[model samples]
Target: MIASYDALSEARKALDTPLFAGLPGDVAVSFEFFPPKSDAMMLQLWDVVQALAPLAPEFVSVTYGAGGTTRDRTHGTVARIISEARLPAAAHLTCVDATKAEVNAVAEAYWEAGVRHIVALRGDMGEPGAPFVPHPEGYQNAADLVAGLKAIAPFDISVAAYPEMHPDSASPEADIDNLKRKLDAGASRAISQFFFEPETFFRFRDRLAAAGIDAPVLPGILPVSNFAQTRKFAAACGAAIPAWMEGLFAGLDTHPAARQLVAATVAAEFCRRLYAGGVRNFHFYTLNRAELSYAICHLLGVRPKAAAAIQEKAA
Candidate 1:
C-alpha cells in the first residue's frame, strides 16, 4: 500500500508502544563502498565492514573511481570481501580508459576470484561538462560493458539509473532510454542515483513502468554524512535538494552530534516512506562510514550478528 513518511512515523511509534510489539525481521540491504586511499582508510573500511556484516546485505559493492582510477584498490577490496569476509561483492567497472580486452580481463579476474557480481557503468568523463569520448578500442557505453561481462561469465550485473536525468543526458527520456539499453544488453538490475524527495524516484519509477521497463530499480540511499559536501555533489550531479532539507540541517553545522542524530532521523524516515511505497530493496552509498548506516539499518530491523561462522567455514 502507498503511504507517506508521516504515516510511517505514526505506525512505527504505535508499533513501539508497550502494548504493540515492534515490526521484526531482517530487511534486505546492500552497501556501496569506495576503495580505500591509505593505510588508515583501509583499517577504517574493515572496521565499517565488520560492523555492518551482521545485516546480511544481499551483497556489497566497491566503487570504481573516475577515469578508471582506483582500479587496483577496487580489485583488492572486492577480492578481500570474497576471499576473507565471506561476503559477496560487486566490483564497479566502467567503459572508460580501458579497451574491450582489458575490461574483459578484469571481469575474468573477478570471476576467477569467485567474485560474481559487477556494477557496470558508462562512467563520468574526467571533467564535468566534457563530452564522453570512448577509448579507441573500448566499449562505447555501459551496454557494451555489460555484454562483455556476460560473455566472460554469468555475472549479476547492476547499472546506474538517473531519477532526475544524468547531467549529460539530453533529457529524462533519453536517460530512461539509456537505462533500458543497459538492461537490454544484459544488466540484471539498476540502482538509481540518490535523491532527497521520494516523489522524484516514484515519478521516475512510474515513468519507467509506463514505458514498459520492468527491471528491478533499487533506490540508492545516501545518508547525509556531511550536509554541505552532499549538497555540492548533488548540485554538480543535477540532483535537486528540496528546501525542506536545508531547513532540517539548519543550525546544525556547529553541532555535530545533533547533526548526526538528525541525519539518522531523516534517513530512517526516507526508507520507511519508500518501504510503504512498495520498495523492498535499498542500496546504501555508505561512503565507508558506519554510524548513520548502522543506526538506519537498526531502525529498519537489521541487527548485528556473528560473522564468526562464515569466516571459519570459508577458512
Candidate 2:
C-alpha cells in the first residue's frame, strides 16, 4: 500500500542520510530561566535571552525559587524580559510559605505588569528532604493554586508533570491523578520535568492518553553540560540517567569544549528520536546558558526567524 511504502522510504532515509540533514525545522520551542541573584548574573541572563530570542520561542519562563525566596527577583526578571526583550514571558508562582491573600496579591501585580502567563507549582520546601507543608491559610496544592488563579484572572497557566514520578508521590497513578486535578482546575498545559530518554516521554504520553487527559504536555529537555551536577538533579527528581550516557561523559572532565560537543550530539540525537516520533513542541531548561540549547536547536533545524524567512523568500 502507499502508506506502507512511505513508511519504508522514511526508514531508508533515516538509515542512509546524515541524522540532522534536511530537517524542516517545524518544531516549536520554549525556554526556562532562573532569576539572577547578582548584578553580574543579571547581565549574563540578559545576554542569554538576547541570543535565544531570534528563534521565536513560544514563551520564556522565569522560575520561582524554593519557598518563594526569590519573589522580587523573579518579578523583576520577568518584567524586564517582557518590557525590554519584547518576549512573551511567563512568571512562576508557587503555593509555598504564603497565604492565599499573599499569593493572590503577587498574581495581581503580575497582571498589572503585563504578564498573562504563569507556571503554577506546589514548590519544594526550603530544607532538602523535608516534606512540603502548606501554609495554614494557603492553597493546599498546585490544583488549588490553579483554581484560585482562574478566579483572579484569565491567565494562561502551566503546571508541572513528572514523567518518571515525583519523589513524594505514593504511586504513578497518584501522580497522574494529581496532574489531572491540576488540569481540571484550569491549567492550559503541563510541562514535564526534564527527562533523558525519549521512551520515558513516549510511555508517559501513552499513559496520559489512556487516562483520557488530552491537555498539551511539553517535554522538558535539559541538555546536560555538567554530568556530575545532572546526577544530583536526577537523584532529586527521580529521573533516570542511562548507563550509556555515563560512559559517554566519562573522562571528559578536563575537556570542556569536547564535552560540550558530546553533550550536543547526545541531546540532538535524543531530540531527533522524539521528533521522528511526532513530537513538535519542546521546552528547554536553559540554566541561564544559551550555547548548549542553541546548538541543539540548530541541529534540530530551528534557525533564526529572519534567516528562515530569507530562505522561504529565496525558494
Candidate 3:
C-alpha cells in the first residue's frame, strides 16, 4: 500500500498537477475570538490558537463580552497570546458601561502588557430590552471611543463599520458619515460587520471613497460554523441573511460535516470575489473553533507552513 501511494504521488508531481493558487503574497488576514468561560472551552481556544499560529496572521484578537462582561477574561486571554504564543494581539475594548477613566485604565494596562492594537467599540447593553446609555462620564459613542483611545496612546485602533447601514442609523448617509467621523477621529481602519453578499462590501467601500473617507476597511468574514446561530446573530446585528443562505442549510440539521462542506464553499467563493475586486485584507470571526475556519482558509488558498521551507526562502 505504501509503495503504491508513493508511486501515485510521484505520478501526480510529474504531471505538474494544477491546483488553485491562493491570495497574493502581500495579502494579510487577522482573526477574532472571545475569551472562554470554562476549562473545556479554554482548552479548545488554545488548541485553535496553536493550530493557526503557523500561518503568522497579522494579529489575533480576543473580544470583550457585551457590556464588558468578560473584561478580565479578555485581558488574560490576550496577555497569554502575547507572552506564550508570541503573537501580536489586538484587544477589544468597549464603552458600554465604563467611564473615560475606567476605559483609559484598561488601555494603559494593555500598553503595559505590550498590546498595541485595539478594536474599539461602543458595545451593546447586556440585556436586549435595555437601551444603551453612555455613562455620564464616559465617551459618547464609537467615534468618541476611538478619539479617547488615541489620546491614551499611539495604539493602532480599528472601529466597526456597517455596510448595510447600522440598524439605529438615521439614514444610510448618516451611517457612512459616522464611519468617516471614526476614521477622522484617529481609527486606523474599520472592520465591517459581516455581510452575506460581496456587493454589500463593494458598495460600502465605494461610498466611503465618494464621501472622501480614505481609511482602510477590512472585510469581516464569519464562517458558518452553525448556520442557525449565525442566522439569528445576523438578524440581531442587521446583517442581511439572503434567501439563498436559508435554502443552502435547509436539511443538514444533524449532518454537521456536510454543513461544513457547504460553508467552506460559500465563504471561499465570497473571498475569491472580494479578492478579485482588489480587497486584500480580511478579518475572520473565528468563533473559537479552527476546523471550519481552517477549511475555509484552505479553500481560499491559505495553508499551513513548513519551517524549513520558510528558512530556506529567507536564506
Candidate 4:
C-alpha cells in the first residue's frame, strides 16, 4: 500500500522524536576541523578539541584548504592530535595544484607521524564559486588520489559523496560511478556532504546498495548554528533548504539563544530519523564549534566518554 503523505510525515515525526530517557549510550561519530590560521583561532580550536575529545569519536579529521593552501598547517595539526592528544587523526588530502609525488610525500609524512586515515578529495580551485581545473601534474581527481594513497600506505581512506549531485558531477549516475571508482581504488568509506532531509540520504543509500556498492556511506550531519549563513552555504552546495526549516528560523535575526536552541532541536530531529533508518555512524562538520554537535550526539545515544589513551585501545 502506498503510504499517504500525511501518514509518512507522522511516522517520520515519531521516528524523529527524541527519547530523553534510555538513550542508547553508544554510537560511532567522527568530527572534521580545519587547520587554524591565527594564534587566537588556534586557541579556540584546541578548546573545542578538548571539549569534544571527551566524547571519544571514532576518529577526528583536520580539513585541508582548497588547492592545498593549508597543507603544512594541516599536517602539523593532525600530527599534534596523534602525538599529544592521543587521538586517531585523519588528514585531508586533495588533488589540486600538486603533483602525484607531492601528494604522496604528504601521505608519507602522515604515516610517519603515526596517522592512519586520510580524507581524500578532488578539491575545487580558483575560488569558492569559480571553475575547477585539475592541476597539470597532480592526480586528476579523487579516485586517482585514493589509488595513490593506497599504494603509499595501508591508510583508512574516506572520500566525499554528495546526496544532491555535486555541481560539477555529470549526473547522479556519474557521481555514483565516481564514488564507486574511489571505493574500488581502495577507499574504505565515503562521507557525504551535509543535507537536511533524511530521505535524500536514505534514497542515496538505497540506490548505492542497488548498484552493489557495499562500503559504508556515512550520513554527514551539520548542526545549523546560523540560519542565514547555513542557507547561503546549502544553496551553494546544492542542498535544499526545506520550507519548514525556513519558517522556524523566520525572524530571529538578533536572537542568538533562541536560534541555538532551535538549531539543536532541528539537528536532533534530523539525526533521530537517520538513526531509525539504521545509520550507526555519523560524520559532523562541526564548524570548529561544539555545543550543537554535542547535543545531537547525545540524541544519537552517544555520550561523553574518556579519550582512548592509545589508538588501538579505542579501535
Taking all chains together, each candidate's TM-score versus the true structure is 0.90, 0.94, 0.89, 0.92
Winning candidate number (lDDT): 2
Residue 129's lDDT within candidate 2 is 82
lDDT of 3 by residue, 64-128 (tens): 98867898999999999887777788999999888899999999999998899999998888775
Candidate lDDT scores, in order, read: 0.85, 0.92, 0.83, 0.86
Please state every model's RMSD to the true fold in angstroms: 3.4, 3.5, 8.3, 3.4
lDDT of 2 by residue, 173-225 (tens): 99999999999999999999999999999999999999999999999999998
Error of 1 at 130 (Å): 2.3
Model 4: residues >4 Å from true position, as ranges? 1-20, 307-315
Colliding residue pairs in candidate 3: none
Which wins on TM-score, candidate 2 or candidate 4? 2
Better structure of 2 and 3 per TM-score? 2
Residue 229's C-alpha lDDT in candidate 1? 87
- The lDDT ranking, best first, is 2, 4, 1, 3
10 residues in a row with least lDDT, candidate 2: 306-315
Residue pairs in clash, model 1: none
Evaluated against the true structure, the overall lDDT of model 4 is 0.86
